[model samples]
Target: MAASSAVEPTSFDPSKAYKEWEVNGKYFGDGREVALLDYIYNHPDIEQLRGNPEKILRAIDAFAQSVTGLINIGENKGVIVSDVIAQHKPEVVLELGGYIGFSAIMFGSAMKRAGGKQYYSVEKSPLFAAVATSLIDLAGLRDTVRVVVGTGAEGIQRLYDNGLLRSQIGMAFFDHHKPSYTADLKLCERLGLIGKGTVLVADNMILPGNPPYVEWVRASVEDKRAMDKAAQEKGNPNLQYNSRFVKSFEPSGMEDALEITECLGIEGA
Candidate 1:
């Protein structure tokens, strides 16, 4: 009989290649995102804190768990939205969808880093609001970030009632239902929540595209161009309008992930 060679052990370490596998798998692989988020939430360093630290850590954990565990686990749109807010260092932030406060934490963290900023998240789901409120309290951001339970439109009225609209809102994030994006934008405009140089970011623009809203923006840009042309024809001052779409894709193994589209509103134009 021929001598049999010793079989080498398979070196398939899940943790070592987890990220590669995750991206290749297209953001869907046995709840990997959820597991990772849970790990972060339940980390020992975050758990062992006392007083404010402990509360903040708990809020962070709750928020992560609420989004990844309860809502769609593959929804990683928060990354892009959070990154934009963090980079801009906005003084005031308004988020459309609170969703267990995951995005709220990201915004709050960004605001904290930027210094002297506050975030107000509006969530329609009462359950999510409850969870988020608890998490916000735990995260010790009760002073910096406020979670309001209601849609943006409804919350706008409440904000006015509470005298919160006086502060200039620098950034706005839209992550609620796709159909509500345009409506919410209009609502914000009517309520004067967005200023001239305000930054408005909409997530999932491609995967779950909002055709009406997208078309509206296109038409508005065309109208602005026409206005500028008409002004030039009449020897009147031509004001230029700026509009651009930023395309961002979340790295996930799944084919359908998150897409972030940002639109900047020029005040005087």
Candidate 2:
């Protein structure tokens, strides 16, 4: 494990909690996703939701609150990343997970407003991607947000091979399989998809921490080189990073954190 980057935790208001997620077995993919689509389309304000990102987000939140909990960034941590998009003004952004397009609609709208060109969301499940695509279209962000159905590595490879990601990615958000974080990031680094000025934001850092990822990003070039000798997923050891931790809450009112790192360019480049 790496030395932890610390931040003050924000107090959560219990009154704002969503319907708790499944306790025993499944938390997602048991028809609730399609139910979300039905809920949104059947919403009385469906007409008003069209072309309105914020309203669409509100509707999603409504469903999560009254219906069932959703695994999403939600408003709290979402605002934190949204602020980063506004400040950094990334030209193109890549997202490892697209679950239901909540973050896509939220962050995609922000990116478009900031004059960004593209937002690619890679989702592993075709069913999940379908739901996300429908919602993204409903949000009128079809042009800016493109959902790719594949695992993180596969999607990155496809995009890069197709020339869609010919240049370095401006920013990347990791919220997929907890174990895939370091591997997918290494894939990006190996493919030159990340470089100087690229911003990396990883979710679920506290809820279920990712130690290897945190250590890699915060490590010095020399340290990383030594670490890579035993690593199967070899990343660019010389890519310098400055990282920090940010404390925020989940929609379910549970505590979580995001590891935010910025590439400072390759050492001695």
Candidate 3:
């Protein structure tokens, strides 16, 4: 019910000195992902990383701090999601965008500890998905986490069609293409992937801001119905939601926020 920073550490530890994510004309989709693989695989403590999730996370954090910057959730924001996973005890967790598997490993480890089932990381880029898969495996989460290479829509449809995601999604983490957040969520709704007690955690809400996604999640069923008249994504307007905003910080000490939404159930048509 309270904001994310309410329970977590509000201050980013500057002493950690995590390298800022490389930002030129582009933020990701460069050679950095593969390079990260190289860095991890080549680390001196390679053997220690084989089956240690927390150690692997620490190593990755070290790489981000001293080596090339990575666009990962980092320890700061990652801990927030991990804590939610602990409290919610979701049977299955879905990750929209897993660039090199940082969030996947983090949340997957949490899922495993919480006695959850699976963690699905849907990445648009095959290259990134491959990297994420390798890292997740290295973290000993190969059984707990699976990486799917495709757009959010494709991944959702594939999993649903395959009956892997037919059950209600206990918790979904959205960190993919910002614009697709609402569309992808709508797709999930249309497919009945969301139900009572389902939780949706959307990242990068404050830094880049997702007004449309936020509006949709927070809107009343009547308002959503009105919007659906002209919307391309015809989600279940009758579905009810209780939403809130959680303030947090980037690993690099930048300000950001996460929008958490829980499905209350279907409202009257």
Comparing 2 and 3 by lDDT, which wins? 2
Q: On residues 30-78, what C-alpha lDDT tens digit does candidate 1 reach at each position?
A: 5543454455457576554322433453444344344332333122444
Give the alpha carbon lDDT tens digit for every residue of 96-183 in model 2.
9999999999999999999999999999999999999999999999999999999999999999999999889889999999999999
Q: List the residue pairs that clash in candidate 2.
A: none
Arranged by TM-score, best first: 2, 3, 1
Clashes of 3: 0
Cα RMSD for predicted model 3: 2.4
TM-score of each: 0.64, 0.97, 0.94
Q: Which model scores highest in TM-score?
A: 2
Give the per-residue lDDT of model 3 (tens digit) for 1-269. 11232234388788876776766765667677777889889989999989999988898888778866777878877888888899888899889999889899999999889999999999999999999999998998999999999999999999999999997889999999999999999999999889888889999988899999988998888888899998877998888888878888887888888888888888763
Off by over 4 Å in 3: 1-9, 23-26
Residue 108, model 3: Cα distance from true site in angstroms = 0.8
Off by over 4 Å in 1: 1-46, 49-76, 221-252, 255-269
Give the Cα error of residue 10 in candidate 1, in Å.
Answer: 30
Residue 93 of model 2 has an lDDT of 97
By TM-score, how accurate is candidate 2?
0.97
Local error of candidate 1 at residue 59 (angstroms):
10
